[model samples]
Target: MRVGKKLFPYPVLNNSKNNSGFGDSNYQLMITITQNENYFIIEKAYVEVENQDIERMLADGRAKAIMVVECSATVFREKYEIGIEPKDISIPIGNLNDKVEISSFIYANQDIEHFNSNDFLEDFADFDFSIEKYDILAVDDGYTTKVVFDEDKDKKMSSIFSVIKSNNKDLNVMTVSSENKQIVIEMPSQYFDYHDNMKHNDNFQNIFFAIIAIPALTQCLQEIKECFSDVYSMDINEVMNDKTWFVSIANRYQAVFGTELTSDEFIDCNTYEVAQKLLNCGSTKAIEDFYNLLWNGRSDSDDE
Candidate 1:
């Protein structure tokens, strides 16, 4: 609505019944301005259903100004639904009870989409706005996954680009590495047991791989095996064999590789290195070895 030299915007009031007869504008935009210290604030911007008591609310010392907008049948919720801009404005007032809510009730509950916030600002309130759309970047993987957002995702070493890598449970398998940006992958190898309760088609840990995150770096399967083999040289006593899983890996290396690799050799190595060997050792053999180790470890502990 246009006042002497100012224009105020309001919600697209739908289905309002015009009562005051001024072009049947049909709705009212009620604004209560309050003062805190030296500045003025839009304490509340409400949609009043009726315009009967306008003079009484504004005539008081505390109330600043009120406007009536003609939209449809829409009204602001009673609990002061919308947020005001400028946080606090420059309208100084003498009303001590200016903070007290005048317009108590409104019509409906509306979201941010339904209302334009600029309308509530006082004439001097300066506001600026712009819109942003994200650009897409394609990885080597043929975009089977839906892209929620793909901008500035260089894993870590970037000041401009920012990407959110969430644990995407919608995928069959989740591939987490030591890196912050992990992938929801569906390869033949499964490294993480994060989805153990869920059923998946590719749960096989069939290849030895390291979860190294240098952009576009692929797995060096042979290097992983050498790390595991090098670990075989470690003394049996220094190895961390407190866990039950180590016994199985030691037993499995002896059974499948036909080499007397003790738990000290296997458990003493880094986790990724051991994971690589477990992957290259074939999923079937690794699972069988795990169970056998689990059982054999129990038997040995009981014997002692």
Candidate 2:
């Protein structure tokens, strides 16, 4: 049927006996927009009936009651229509919460030339439109992931401590306590052996240490392998075999030292080479033997 405007009426009941024999009844129409978008819109409108006047009208032989609805859309490119039916409208009286709800659907002719025209542009130029709810989904696969590396300064400094301790047993490395989320290393005398080591080898080892602190180590390793194929010739399987490679290295250091260092305490790439050399030569024992070397007693004959 061609869309046309029509009033859907409801009957009222009469309870009061008056000289005029008419009931004092009242009705109210309430309209609300629930959801709307570019293609289609849905709205809810209601009618309310109340009071004795409305009841008296229904008691009389009046078979119909009519309600007038008025609506307009800002966008002229889309033709909006309204539908009304007795089943679609309701009349509830007495209860403040009682309501008759009407549903409306506003659709556009997609094949029309003015489907998205600018006919209403000037009128609602500054109006802001918003939707209450929506759903979006990606139907196909293929997505990109990103990796970012922001160095943790505290971890870097902890690594430096482990590196220094691995080299010298007599050197005391002082660390300052901080309330903020930062690591501060303090030396009683800035002339500590560790500082001397850093001063001499900072250029080469800093880059190595930074790599170990990469946040996404797996991706970082892959990218490094691709870029430096010749330098990093180990296959991914061999590199990832913790039991055969990493554990063996850790065992070697522990065997020489008589004490095992925790994973976090173990020196990182920056000091790995130097630490290996020290462990190989028993530098830790040599540092402890300095007093014995200095205080070795003269021969008995020379004392005589």
Candidate 3:
């Protein structure tokens, strides 16, 4: 499989002087795009303000500023249509000059199941096969990258495994532990081989391609973990402590992302550390933030 595109380097903005009546301060924003199959994911969008700017903004021990990142996409057809504009997703910047990274993805209608399975298939069933691709536009730092994915096929758990196995014949497949759970395959040898080759050749493009493909299998593994956890009345943490349980988690991660974890990568790490690292790499911050924002109150503060 060909790696799609190389992301451009981040553009650094240095706003130091008052131009056209704005403030006179030195601030920098670096924005970069990271692509996956269906999403134009934002790898890093960080803003840095000078200490002087922070000091100037801080008044009465409180300095509140909102940093917004808005995203939009376009769907092309006989009649071109623009997708809904994403909310003014804002993050609060306190009185600190430290770089704050904001990460998100621009998802197309095809990213959703209803659109992919029904709407798109019905609308463009007869069009030229090549022209049926949809584009997802991600706007960051006044630059946009159009991410394209084919709407003809749904990228299910089975399809992903088929592709991987077809590409690498040495893959040793293992079934997920839970019945009724989605298929989570393991290819420890193949994973190691791919990583070694990437390292040897120093192919960052292939490395990123592997990174993007991982989330697909990870989703399947997550379902299996949840099912197993519920059936056994054990937390993921407890399950991960045991070799079998750790293998299960690792298999799930590998299935989705096409990367196998070394024993050092998972077995050595504590439960919380492993979970945190997984959350960070998997782009599951929205789930964490929702819980923190909505349910965490006075009792939550006490627990913290």
Candidate 4:
């Protein structure tokens, strides 16, 4: 989220020069990233330019906005094209363990002779000059952001877990595990393939989460209860403090119930109630979506 002034060698749009009549308000760059397990870091990037001259240049291919990303941890660096239309980008998440630095700039797409802009400084505003290709015209402040691979309590279920095939023949449906913060749902190979194929459907997503997360959360709460059966003697922080998964589930319990997870109310609650609270009664939504899918057949078109 870096937004500030940057120094450039050439006379470009910036906040420094007096009478430039151009500043950050005239140009802006925005970038957002989403982590997809260990596969790729997806980026949605775009730039905003208020100046009509710059907009015309971009529209006619005289100028281009570019996003420059660098990750020291992974030793990865790459440049991407960006503009008014949002750009979807993906970079392989290979050993990407630390902060990623991102910077953006608008560059001359080709040589421009007699470049003149009403937004330019007084001296340059009326003068026409030759600008070489690849010359920087505008720059955005640089910043750093991190990508997390571990499943903390703050992350969503999608980020916290992945589905994989189970080698065990006796296992029927699915089982959950939160190992090394890479939570996984393991099922028999056949069921695993089915789950993978159908999990992307919005309706199936709600149903799958209900079936897997509820039971997993219930079992997790039971472990906490067994380990600290005496609520009075329980120090919530001390119980499974070393296990991130345990701490995450405990935090979720408190989040849902609005009380310490080791409190008497939590201890007295039954498995069903605990599941309901943990999921915030997610099953209700599942049922609603299920009925919609069955009756509506997933069509958004109105019958004219």
TM-score of each: 0.19, 0.16, 0.21, 0.44
Model 4 CA deviation exceeding 4 Å by range = 1-6, 14-25, 148-304
Clashing pairs in 3: 214-256, 214-257, 217-256, 218-256
**Clash statistics: count for each candidate:** 16, 8, 4, 0
Please name the candidate that would achieve the greatest lDDT relative to the true structure: 4
1 or 3, greater by TM-score = 3
The residue-by-residue lDDT of candidate 4 on 1-304, one tens digit each, is 1325444434576422331346433666776667776554545688877778778898999999888887775787888888888777777666554567777778899998877676665544567668899977766655566644444434653444567898888889777665645456788988888878987665565566567766676665676677666555876555433344555556677777677666566567786667755565656656766677789966232110
What lDDT would candidate 4 get against the real structure? 0.65
Whole-model lDDT values for every prediction: 0.29, 0.28, 0.33, 0.65
Arrange candidates, best TM-score first: 4, 3, 1, 2
The TM-score between candidate 3 and the true structure equals: 0.21
Off by over 4 Å in 2: 1-131, 134-173, 176-183, 192-194, 197-304
Error of 3 at 291 (Å): 72
Q: Name the top TM-score candidate.
A: 4
TM value for model 4 = 0.44
Ranking by lDDT: 4, 3, 1, 2
lDDT tens digits by residue: candidate 1, 1-304:
2222222233222212221112222334445454445443554454433232222222332122322222111221122232212122233222211112222212222122222133223432344322111110000110011111223333221111112334555554323322223222332233234323222223222211222221111122223335456776544322222222233344444655577875444445454444434434243344554465577641111110
Instruction: Please say which candidate is ahead in TM-score: 2 or 4.
Output: 4
lDDT of 3 at 219: 47
